[model samples]
Target chain A: MKKFLWYFSVTLLAIIFMFPFVWMLLTALKEPGTALVLSLPKKLTLYNFKKVLFEFGFSRFFLNSLIVALSSATVSTLFASLAAFAFAKKSFFMKEYLFWLFIASMMVPGLLYVIPQFLIVYKLGWINTYWGMIVPHLANVFGLFLITQFMRQVPDSLLESARIDGASEFKIWWRIMVPLAFPIVATVFLLNFQFHWSNFLWQLIVAQSEEMYTVPVGLAMFKSAHEEAYTLEMAASSVSIVPISLLFIFAQRYFIEGITQGAVKG
Target chain B: MKKGVRDNINAYSFILPFAFIYMVFLFLPFIYSIYLSFNQVTDFSDVFGGLSFVGLKNYLFLFRDKEFWWALVVTLYYALIIIPLNIVVSLLLAILLRKRYRLNSMYRTFFFLPFVLDAFVVGIVWTFIYAGRYGLLVNILKPLIGGIYETGFLGNAKTVMPSVALAMTLKGAGFGMILYIAALDGIPKEVYEAAELDGATGLKKLWYITLPLIQPVTTFMVIIGIIGALSAFAEFYAMTGGGPIVYKWGTPLGMTKVTGLYLFNHFSNLRLGLAAATSFVLLVLALGLSITYSKIQRKR
Candidate 1:
């Protein structure tokens, strides 16, 4: 039946789509030295993940990633929301010009900024420091831009009422704008969180010490350094894969919408 | 009407905190990079000491740098393949899933799952898949074609970029599929019903209705894809480390060293002048292509 064919095709595609993740689990569970030819786990063990955690310092890397990603996403969202409030609701001279300048600056590829920024950071003695990992990226223009777009839809009458109630701009932003824009900001926060979680290049450059490496950079370093240790490497990546998959499952709706909005508007 | 000074002060206060830091990290770099491109600094400390103006020496040097040209070619090849392939694959998947069906959301989530994983994580996963002698892909294909994929595609110089490109396309299609699905859902059902009433067949509806309606989304995806291809780094670092050198016109070239890695190499060596120039050139190329593409689209 045509109906049967439809379900069959979709189910097949879904399985194929999930094949790598399934393989990742299988590979992670396999005993060390298990042949790649063995599609199924042979005497499944957490030995590989344990090796990565204990020997390769994956726990340290995960903690570092969590600290950096959590702080950066939260701080960046706070700053961006404040700025977005001003842009959306306030009357300021040269505001349009200045905002355009900010947006236009984004057109210059981020690669162009790395060298100079690194030089400046080095001059300031921030290299190999957590400040190196966190501060330089806190003002992501995309986050500001996304929050601004969401804030503009916030009814001006609501803000006017707050003003009439003698609420200060900061208080209004905290009390009213915060609640009103909470949904979008939450979405953007998670997006930024995932983004920082996956940040490999910046983390790679900044982390001179193995102790400082974030999850992505640590996973990468683990791979190249322990080249033949396929099972261990698979386990290391599974660390990232598991959390992200869980994130996708729990926040799938926001991610689906947030990612799409960031795409089309961005 | 006379504007109040209070509004201006309040606005500046709110904006300056971010604007100042953003300028220090972002805007200042934009200008300094251009200046750095014209000056030589051999060490990171020397960058603080002073920059010796060399005019366009770095640019001239880059012009003759075979590695840079090869990187440019590799980038172009990636864009040429990835841009179209990503858009088409995602678009086809979107069209297939356009109709409301059982487990549609599950299907979409599965498709979009790979995109949620970081590029480096995905790269590691693919490296396992491409692990020459001990690869899932190799194991699966070995029975059909004996030893052809014995070592795996990533290790082979000729196949490395293509191999990376294939992995990237597979992971990347999910992102664009979400974009297309959203775009498709936005198209009014009345429009389709009207088309059906007009005797517009399936192919006709797709060509005249779906394609044209989603043209803007397509353009946006292409521009983003082009920039992505040009600036590809994390995955390459994780997957290839920009290695498995091939002899391109007798020059030892990294088969997968796209522009991003090329710049990273320069940065690591403290060749700030060259790195700055390369970034400038790439910035221009990216912005130029984006402008040109948009202009072309506007004209049409």
Candidate 2:
């Protein structure tokens, strides 16, 4: 009886957590007029999704988000690993001070950088461009810290052996350190990807043109502009969530590991 | 000696890419923001042109700005509510799911699922759930609880902040749960076994053994939660737009406008100087909390 009660409560909690997403999907599938009603749709249809994708030009936004997130994550991770390798295995002047400087920067509220970064991006004539969206965010201090923490645990003997083999520093990082630190590297990449994918404020500020709008920006605009279009809003929200949700489900281990590792150790 | 020099050269080469970007984008902008805070930029479009120095004017203006104080209060209230609520919910979930069960992993996945979502998307879905007439909550409760929820949770001044905080708490609890689960896993089994042997069972065991063991995680969560609450923006932007405007002392304040949103509002209005000042205030608050956290960690 006790075990049954436990299962029951857990299941109830699960239902509570899952309800909003379920409702969103259901409303998206419903006809426009029926979206507000809670009952099952009388005739489920793909009308809302189709409209959002084509008529609202969400496909373009979706593509923009993908390109931005992918490039940002890849470049951010690559640079972070290079710096992490230096911080972890190599001896450099002021290495400790530099690493601490990076760590301290993380504590400063991100809002402080917004006005200045925007001006800098504008000065570079990157407004309404992917460069504006991606460049400012590439120097990810948190990613650097995370990768540095992981790479520090990497055995130094392996690097010494690679050095003895006359491997160049770049080749050593690419061939040895990367493969060995692949899990954490992948974790940093995935975290960065997720961050850029849903990053709204920066994208909103930079992507002034409709074509450059990412998923979150487009959805926010869509919701506000079409306030009465409940079905369409639901569809757009669904589009914004589905890709990340699918990715999370498939690679949940990395997501969980990355989050916990960062919090616990840092 | 030459090898040492060569090693230093290689290290600097490796660090140069990130350091260059960091210097130009992050470090430089950070310094520039301070400079911007002291000067009034005449044009939003051309921040570099027509800049007039107005030392401490922005900061002084914010000192008397009731709207800014209200945002700080809302942010503090949000932090107070969300930190405790999230810790309780997440700690409970972690404790409950700690023991191996038939569907434990599935239950964990279900709870953690929401954390993976964008706050904007979650906020939008929640707005519908809290919609006035035909919202799921209203429709479900109208017959039982009656018209109180008619304006919906996000539609009222009294309830709007807590309502948004609740949505955020649900979205965030999974993260805390993950942390707690890891912390709980680290607690040696012998401690629990010894407690059981001493006739401490059930809640007694939990209060005495489990709670103390997870205090570090609690502290971590509290600090992180406080920082997260202070910097909260996307949810307010998406759900309320810091709305259901309430008037106090003849001033209109957004009921949900925390410091992050307040900063964004200033920036949007092209009040660049004020925005930078607001950010500095937020930075001090965040840094203070982080310092307190580190102090606590060191004490242990």
Candidate 3:
């Protein structure tokens, strides 16, 4: 009886969790007015998805999102890791001050800075460009803080042994620390990808042309179109949702571990 | 001294990229925003002009702006409503899933799917669900609530904010559940075992033991909840585009145009100075709230 109840609740929760995606799929398959009912379609078709991807240029937007997410993750991780190393290993004047400043910046509501950041992007003539999105985000305080905490856990003896073998600091970091920190690197990459991929306001502010629009901004614009085109909008929504959900499926362990670590060390 | 200087140089090189970008982008922009808040400029082109300085006028204007105050009230209302709603529902769900259960990981992944979703995507999906006419909700309510047939949840002034809040609350509660589940796992089993020895079970054990233990995690969730509610932009932008008009249930976004959305609009139109001023206002509000909340937490 207990087992049966458990299974029932599990199935129910899963259904509830997947209701929207199922709705999106059903909506996409339907001829417009048919979707107005919650019932399943008697027919299935791929027209809405095709129209969104081919006719509406969703493919370009997806590619743009992929490029931005990948580039931001790679560049920001590299810079953040290097900064994290400095904070973890070195004792210098204002080191504590700098670290604290960065930590404080993490808590600063991002909305407050969105406008200022846009202004900076404008002044640099980077509006509607890749560099505008990528540059400001390169200094990720959370990434820096997380990496620094993880790097501090590395045994100093390992680094000393490498030094005794005449390894340079860079070499030590590249060879020893980098491999040991793979879990964190993966976490940071996934988190950053999740953040940058779903970033809307930034993309909305900086990306002028439809060609440059990322998925979130693209989805926003798509939803804002004439109200009657709900089928196509749902199709576009599913396209964005599927990839990120797949990403989480693959990286759920790391994402959970990262948040747990943040709480423990925080 | 020379050797120390060499180490300093190496450190500087290590920190250079972060420092340079932060100073140029974040720090400088922050200062410039404060300056812009004091000056008046009509457009982006006029930003560099020698415009007359108007001290505290923008802020004063914001104070008198009924829409801004309404936005503030609505925002607080939304935060107050959603925070407890998420905490209670997530905590209960976390407890339900905490025991030995088949398909546990599967259930977790499914529940957490929404947090990973783009808010814009969720907005699109929920818009369909909440559509005024021919929407799933309307279809369901047509037979039951006759008057509700014509009234879309988001389309109606009375229901718009609450309906949006409900959607967000549903989407967000899942994430809080994940966090609480993680926290719940750390709670030592002995505490429960001890409670059982005293013949406490169910609600009694939960209130006396479990709630106290998870207080820290609950605090963290509350802070993040407030920030999340206040910083909410994508869903509102995607769903309502601010609003049809500020209703009784209107959000800050509906009433005064949230700073984030306003920033996007103003900057897109090339009104950079006013955008900057608006940013400063947002910054002050956020800072003030954070400090107030931190103080409240510290006292607790």
Candidate 4:
């Protein structure tokens, strides 16, 4: 009886948690102007998806988001890894002070940087461009912290052996440190990817033109513009969510590890 | 000494790329924002060209602005509700799911799935769920209850903030759950066995042994929750657009206009100095809470 009660509650909570996504998919499949009901649609169709992707120009937004998220994630991860390797492995002047300064900056609220960052980006003629969407965020202090933490645990002897082989510092980082730290590096990559994928406010501010809007900004604009079109709106929402959901499903381990490690250790 | 010098050169070369970007983007902007807060810029196109020294005028104006005060209240209200709801729900779920079950991983996945979603996406979906007449929740509850939910949760002034808080809590609870679960797993089996040897049973064990052990995670959650509440913008922007205006003291104010949204609105309207001032207020609040958090941690 106790086991039965436990199973019942867990299943109930799961259903409650999943209901919104299920409702979204069902609504997207339903025809436009249909009554909003709890029951599943009698006839499922892809018309709404097609309309959102093709007619509403969500495909363009999708591509833009892909470019920005992928580029930002890859670049940030690479930069963070290089910097983390130096901090973790090398001897340098003011190294501890420099790293602590980076960590301290993380405590300052990100909101404080937005206005000034916008001005800087605008001055550099990056507004309405991919650089505007991606450049300002590449510093990624949290990513640096995560990678540095992981790299410190890497055996120094391995790097020392490589150095004995006359491998330069750049090659040691590229060929030795990065491959050995692949797990944490991947975690940072996925975290950064997810951040840029759903990054709404910064993208909304920087991408002034409709043409440059990423998925989150585009979907927001789409919803406000097409408020009454519930079916199409659900389709747009699903389009924005599904790819990332699929990524999460496949890379569940990294995502979970990254989130837990990021919070717990910090 | 020579090798140490070479090490410094090698390290600087590696660190230079990230350092340069950090200096240009983050460090410079931080200083510039503090400067901009004290100066008024009249032109969007030419921010520097139109600058005038306003000293403390912007900060003084925020102190006198009713909307600013209301935004702060709404932000506090949001934190008050969301922090507890998130902590309780996530803690409960973590304790329950801590041990293995028939479908434990599936249950974990279902709960954590929403965390992967963008806040904007969750907001839009919940907006539909809370829509009047045609909303899913309204339709489900109408036959069982009444038409009281016709305007739905987001449509009314009184219910809007709580409704937004509920939606955000549900979306974010998964994150806290993961943290709590990890912390729970870290507790030794001996701790529970010792508690059971004492007169402690289920709830008593949870209160005496479990909660105390998980206090650090709870503290972490609260600090993160406070910061999240202060900086919360996307959900409000998506769900309420910071509105469903309510009249108080003969002045119209947005029912859900938290500080982050207020800052965004000001920045959007080209009120640069005021927006910077609002951000500074948020920054100070966040830093103050963090300091208090660290102080408490140290005391414990």
**Model 1 stretches astray by more than 4 angstroms:** A35-37, B1-3, B143-147
Residues B1-300, model 3: lDDT tens digits: 998888888887888888888887767766767777777765446455645688888778766765656656667776777788889878867876886676788888877778778887898798889876688888877777555567677766667777777777667777778778878898898889988999998899889898888887787887787677667788878777666564453433364244445555655675555556666666667667766876787787
Q: Is candidate 1 or 3 superior in TM-score?
A: 1
lDDT computed for candidate 3 = 0.78
Clashing pairs in 1: B132-B151, B132-B152
At residue B152, candidate 4 shows an lDDT of 80
TM-scores for the candidates? 0.96, 0.97, 0.94, 0.97
DockQ of 4: 0.80
Question: What are the runs in model 2 whose C-alpha is more than 4 Å off?
Answer: B144-149, B293-300
Q: Distance (Å) between predicted and true CA of A221, model 1?
A: 2.1
Interface RMSD of each: 1.6, 1.0, 2.0, 1.2
In angstroms, the error of model 3 at B89 is 2.1
True contacts kept of 1: 0.73
What is candidate 2's DockQ?
A: 0.82
Question: What's the residue-level lDDT of B136 in candidate 3?
Answer: 86
Model 1 TM-score? 0.96
* Model 4: per-residue Cα lDDT over B1-300, one tens digit each: 897888788889888889999999999988888888999987766986789999999999999999999999989998999999999999978977976878898899889989989999999999989887878777767876354467787878877888898888788888999999999999999988987888799999888899889898998888988899999999998999988888985799998899988999899988888899889888899879877986888698
Instruction: Write out the backbone clash pairs for model 2.
Output: none
The global Cα lDDT (0 to 1) of model 1 is 0.84
* lDDT tens per residue, model 3, A1-266: 97788778777866876787888888888876576666788788888889989888899999999999989988888888888888988777789999998787777677657666876787789988999977888888888889999899999999999999999888987898878888997898888888899888788878999999987787777766756787788888888888988889988998877777777566
lDDT (Cα, tens digit) per residue for candidate 1, span A1-266: 86687778778877767787788888888998884556687588999989999888999999999999999989888888888889988878888987898788767777788887887788789998889888888787877888888889999999899899999888988998878888778887888888889988788888889999998888877776877887788888888878878977898888777777787787
- Candidate 2 vs 3: which has more DockQ: 2
